[model samples]
Target: MAGGGIGGALGGLIGLACAVLPGPAPIAPVSSVDTSLWSAATLERGRQIAAAGDCAVCHTAPGGQTNAGGFALETPFGTVYSTNLTPDRETGIGTWSYEAFQRAMRKGIARDGSHLYPAFPYTAFAKMSESDMMALYAYLMSQPAVRNSPPRTKLPFPMNQRPLVAGWNWLFHDERAFVPDETRSAQWNRGKYLVDGAGHCGACHTPRNAIGAEKGGFAYLTGGSAEGWDAPSLVGSRAAPVPWTEDTLFDYLRTGFSAEHGVAAGPMGPVVAGLSTLPESDVRAISHYIASLSPRVDPAVSADAAAAHAVRASAAQTLDDEGGRRIFESACAVCHAESGGVGHFGVRPLMGLNTSVALATPDNLLHVLQHGIDRPATAELGYMPGFKDVFDDRQLAELASYIRARYAPGQPAWRDLESASARLRAHAH
Candidate 1:
């Protein structure tokens, strides 16, 4: 249901309707740049710049419709798809003027001048410069056009409506262009622009308000999520038992591994894998941007003297059983062993992963073990399977307790899967 077979067919129908409609496009025209301004080198730069925007990862359909717009973007309110940005006369942006493109990209308005749902992160992009905007347009103009139409989403009652989106915009969106802080070095400012503007990483990584818009005025990198994956804070000051240094974060961003951080899991896993395809320089730039943020130490972490040293002195033990180790060897060794048994099918190292070790709460780990986990929970494009029926509470606890000791933080601890399962069910999207 989450992937194309049904969603794609439905989305394609919706795309056809929107493409066939006759009227002003949802966006307005953008000002022109001299064609001479876009030379071969500039086009290449534009291509790299385009990757920073990460368009294909969100817009393309499963089994790859490249830019044809049939993939579903799940939200707390409803699901949406990446719109066609191809130059197709009917199914894409063939007739869009520069001004309209700018408005849509920066203001969340469509060529038709209608408001777009914030699921598209124009609020962050609104900070991008007009020149860079031209570059993006050039890049998009160069891509191949696919003719598929996506489904017309069926939203519940009032949430289905649009005009109200304008009001939502006024309350939550920031309309200003970015102001460079002269006090900061040029590299820092460039990093800021890339992350806050074209990258749009904050759209998912940042915490949201009751109304679901980002809590913008905050340092802009504290983490929050409703999906099973909890985006850790980027601030880096939090005393996670696993330390994330610049070198560590950079390696993970580039090759998807660092001694401190493992390959990304959940939604982040796919994102990093995609980012890995991008040039290393751009990835480094992204690191520069994130590293510039002052690490904010959470009160809970800052006040804990034990966690500061990452010491497990006070953390509870997960097991009291002699059979714990044998249970793990029999049931989990294939995926958790050092011979690299963990592969792309949601089998993570399970060792040294912070989530596995966080048995204090145990909600995330238990939910995955009980129900299995959907790695790319929304769909493949990224795939993580669910395992609910595989093991009951007691077996899971035994295996989990053993694995945590061998691989996760020190002093492996046992937990109540019943309580964890209930919490996961109540909050699952």
Candidate 2:
């Protein structure tokens, strides 16, 4: 009777677990294909879809094979290693059936019935259309199957338990395809789909709750942290003095640089680099959608905007007795203050107008100062050597304060700069 009672309790526990799950268990794939037999156009479309999602950016490790995974994505919980998407039967998704793949993409369920961590950004992918999902799957399966197994994710204690993720899904996951807004223009709708669904821009751009789940509704895509860099706000409370026009956004997205905004650095650099591969129309659509989110007035006509743009200190004012200015003259003024000339390194520095210095928070400026800007994706853009070794915490603070005051005059002084610099330097590793 005791044994019977124990068995009954075990069965009850299993039932409860199943009930809490997002969906039924995925069936294992029975067959394996050596080659993708998809049409050329379909394959090409799949390639575009994969690029739109920037799949390779996360899946591929630095100097590693494409989609071979093993890239470590750091989260508040811990580090989650990316899974191989190649066609390798053992280490990758080669054995995954269409149903299993669909469930994994839309519902965050793995083929063996394990819960995939949200670091995979499946929440956003859940909004992807069925056709796009299939196309992405095809593109990944067609890649050369690298027989590499990535390290398993190691979360702390209770968080490591995979079953707990079900509760996370129950609270946050939306297992549905994207539904277009019929009232909006096709370009607008397309942008919405790409941003909200396939591109999952909010994964990095949107701030998150305490649980690391992204905050939705009004808090959507305002600003967030990526890796370590603070992703500046994309709305009207944007970092730049001159508001982002669709054309400027398009330029930044397509080429990783805008004359007005300066060059993309840190995490944004790679993202824009990947975006360069996408079609111009798609980038334009994304810009249009993002621009619609904010109520920024055109910088051309707004006198307020013109005044803000003119906030930078004049050359004479740059020589003030403030310790910040003295430091800038000694260290920063050479390359940054020098004007238009020739060749890659000869390109004039974008002070005063740089979006990085103009941001409300000094985090981006701190990031660039600590790590420096390196545009390796395009050698033509040149690079800025990191001054972390050269400047101690106090010096770094003074330098950041100087840049903000001299270049971004209207913006208030960044508070607690010394502590902020110290914190940033601590994480520089």
What C-alpha lDDT does candidate 2 achieve relative to the native structure? 0.77
TM-score of each model, paired residue for residue: 0.73, 0.88
Best by TM-score: 2
lDDT values, one for every candidate: 0.62, 0.77
Task: Give the alpha carbon lDDT tens digit for every residue of 218-331 in model 2.
Answer: 989988888877787787755776677777788778877666666777888777776777788989999999989988557464435534454434455643438777777777
Q: Identify the runs in model 2 with alpha carbons over 4 angstroms from their true place.
A: 1-19, 34-36, 302-311, 318-322, 338-349, 375-379, 426-429
Model 1 weakest 10-residue run by lDDT: 376-385
Q: List the residue pairs that clash in candidate 2.
A: none
